[model samples]
Target chain A: MGEFHFYTKLDQTLLLGVKAGNAEELLAGIQIVPDSSIYHHTHRYLHQHHYLSPEPPNDFAYWTAHVLGDVVLGERLWSVDIVGFQSIAELRQTFVNILEGHLASTRRRIDCAGGQEFHFMASRTYVLPTPHVAHNLAEFAHILNKVSINSLYFHVFDAKLRLERGENDFSRWFRSLGKTELAEKSSRLDPYSHTLDGLRREIIAMVEKHGSD
Target chain B: MARIEDYASFVGQATIDELFLLARHLEGKSVQNVNSTAVGGGVAEILSRMIPLLKQLGVEARWDCIKGDEKFFATTKKFHNGLHGVAVDVGDDEYEHFLEVNRRNAGEMTFGDIVFVHDPQPVALIENRAEIGRRWLWRCHIDFSRPDPKIWKFLDQFVARYDAAVFSAPAFAQKLSVPQVLIAPSIDPLSDKNKELSEEAIASVFERFGIDRSRPIVTQISRFDYLKDPLGVIQAYKLAKQRLDMQLVLAGGGATDDPEGPAIMEQVKEQASKDADIFVLFLPPASDIEINALQRGSTVILQKSLKEGFGLTVAEALWKAKPTIAGAVGGIPLQIAHKYSGILTHSIEGTAQWIKQLISSPAYASKLGENGREHVRNNFLITRHIKDYLLLFISLFHEGDIVYL
Candidate 1:
């Protein structure tokens, strides 16, 4: 009811991860802003990008505000594709790279110890551009299951997307060992004007609708 | 009339002044708290009281909760039981459900300068520290001295992410690599529930509840959860009733997240139905004054919890200078100083024995009540808690900033 205070800087731990390369740059940028100033700037930024409009209808404004302020939405920023890797070797290498860059050597060692125990199956498919990321995620999960690591995982896609798509056809298919629709769409659209251009149009339209709603 | 300063005599003005000074020192510091529910539990109650006081003191303190669905709550209830050394079925779906809720809550709430995530229910909110800059502190109110390995490992990941962790008792602390602090929970002596009641006020409350002033009353006011052991309280009262002319009052309400509460309450009602003297009260959330009246009107108070997270109600009864017998678990030890302040027992038999002794011996009960009020004044009052939090907020900013002023 009072004035909504937007945090100026990105969260410190999130910033630390970004500095280490565990997270993205754009996200880490918000760590330094004042709390109230963040909302003002982000609202303006989203408006310019057509993610929102200044004078959208009440419903559009409400949902737009909700999405912007929601911490759940921001969680997808550094989302690694758990199912994207081809092999345990690939997963190991990517983790090694992350540890060498984004985390301390000691932390990386811990991550590796935990990573080795993880086993992602084609069974735990999630809604993303690829299915393999889910498999890759299984590595960390396996480690978590085996080891005594008391860590918190957001599982952003697992929590929000899985529920939205429903437990039927799409979710069941995603949980299977097959490929996902988004990845296929992107691949098909990669070479053609229809897929990329059509996606662009959709994003623009969604942003417009969100802005003015 | 019941402003914060009204508690000065009990908590000491010098102590209150020092807390204000500490809060002022941390005026620019940002702090946050994360817990399960914002309304039903003790953490929420304390935060609701503490946050406003923090703002009044000029330090910015925020509160947040970890989001969970019905399935997530069910899993976490198992996690809670397991943390207290109860074995339950916790498979992959349970773990996934738990993570799903944390992810949802983490996405919805805002982070502060320093984050204080309370209990296991919302521990996952710390995962965002990789993106947020404020210092994060994990506050554990539950006893985890002998937690189940399966559940503890799942929680350890998030606990390790924070800068520091706080526990209520020494026994409850685990072997964490991070720095840990010990700060016991406290009650507001100036609050309506804890303030002294007049003869007329006490009498009116007893009359309204249909409690005869002639008969000695024994009451236990807490949530209708098994951990609080309301049915066990009834059993203890029944045992004590065989020797003395007394009435038993089991007054408690339900929490939103605790789905098993209604079933537990039904069981308690069934147990209490054998005797007419057993008064089973299902009080609403806004029944704080009624609770105050019940505690005040009672000859003795009981908090026979099997597991507890600092029974503030015990402290509330003790603050009113009522002789109380409580189970020695969680934060109960901090409030009761054995025979000095109040009595602490483990089993229903021990609770019954203490109740019988206190009810039969009026002089001893009065002596214990006198000692208990001073105990609350010296340690468990809200002013002391405010000081502890203010100092915590100040510690986040400076490594060597100390002032005699």
Candidate 2:
């Protein structure tokens, strides 16, 4: 089964909140991180693989309405003014409740008995790399601070998407910014030869080594 | 230096005086033209004539050619076809190669007061304009009304960065963010290709090509490109020959950058070999006097193009007072006023019909030829072309500045 990769900052923040069992820390993580940096990679990955969620997101309401394909649910989600929540825990709970409500209301089943019984098949589950490899919170913090590497990884990721679709706009624009080596490497990248998880692991290792230096 | 007054006899003193007035406005500004080729194509032909004339009018003008290898040119040739609405497979690799070549050329290029980049070959040079700091103008000499969506989208980015864009016809203009100027291409009346030739010289050309002077001759002069529809011209000639006894001359040569010419020439030769009435003469470059003789010797001229930039041959033929029948595509319609100056045809059958009618009715053919010559004299001459360019250069400094002439 193919694995899905998360942005290092997002992964680090989620790991910290889960370990500490603190929803407030998770909310702090979401707020502190620039939304575009996280969202741009997700949107590009989904769009490139032709796995886009119906109406692709341009903003919060559109993203919810189109991606989730539920206008009323999207309106309810939009009603929670992201900035108005007094605590990160409250914001976290609101998101969790809306998702749980959507799952409960939209559940479906099929009966397949006509004298003969058939076995139901389960689809392969997506996996994410464990974030515990970093020894401590300090190591995790150091990794997250390497935002320049995140930006580099974004170029590498975006370039692969463009190459797969036989487009060079991103790479050309990348070169125009005086990033010739990065642009050249991006054009030469073969997406099939390297998986997203594999690239993420390599970037994490590089960031950890750089922190040691 | 050929002065502006040299064209007075052909275009009149009033036009010459007007051009001089406009040239005075462009006094010290230097104009640099960038294109892909130095020979063979209309862009090179026009620049060769225009630059010297621009100098004579006291407007400093220079020309440069962008360097590219075979693969780069092969890719750009596809771009040329794609821009003309022809389906071509231009993927990421092609785009990469195109940009790589442009990047190399961009490193060597230095701009002037007015940098005129021609066609798609050197269009990407505008990417360096921020550092160079010059007013850049992109002159599109091809029909770009409908272009490949992907290619057009990519080119549009560079085009948007330019100060202004120039097109040969109003129909060729796209909805560009920058201002667009419509200036039709012109033929040099004093050049070897359009200069007056003696009957002896015309007869010698016929003898050289072994063309039978006894039979009425119909000719189409253009490069052997599929867009020119040379095979379709042969079909039209065959159809016309069914009703009347006549000879056909398909005379043209290839440009260096156009790799499709030899293959298209082979296809044209194979099509023409079916009959002896047709003469497929592949003239060498700079055979202007020979081209002039061929146009003058023709009873009727045909330019049956599927798509054209400006079809300068139509203007060249009309200037010779030949009853020209050109395809009703691209900038051909701008020159031919349909049943007035010359005829415009849409298909092989239509071209055949016009050729047959013009051959049979000498009086009507002669009248059309007379009207066509006058039209070219008043509009499509080099004198007017120089005036238009001078005014364009002057207008760049003064936006919303209208010149009353």
Best by TM-score: 2
DockQ score of each predicted structure, in the order shown: 0.01, 0.01
Instruction: Show where candidate 2 strays beyond 4 Å.
Output: A1-213, B1-3, B67-75, B89-109, B224-226, B254-275
In the order shown, the candidates' Cα RMSDs to the true structure are 27.0, 27.0
The Cα local distance difference test for each model comes to: 0.58, 0.66
Q: Report the C-alpha lDDT of model 2 over B243-325, residue by residue, as the tens digit.
A: 99999999988633456767888887887788787898888877989999999999999999887777789999999999999
TM-scores for chain B, listed for all candidates:
0.84, 0.88
Q: How much is B214 displaced in model 2, in angstroms?
A: 3.5
lDDT of 1 by residue, B271-342 (tens): 878888888888877877788888888899999987776678888888788999998766675576566578
Residue pairs of candidate 2 with colliding backbone atoms: none
What DockQ was computed for model 1? 0.01
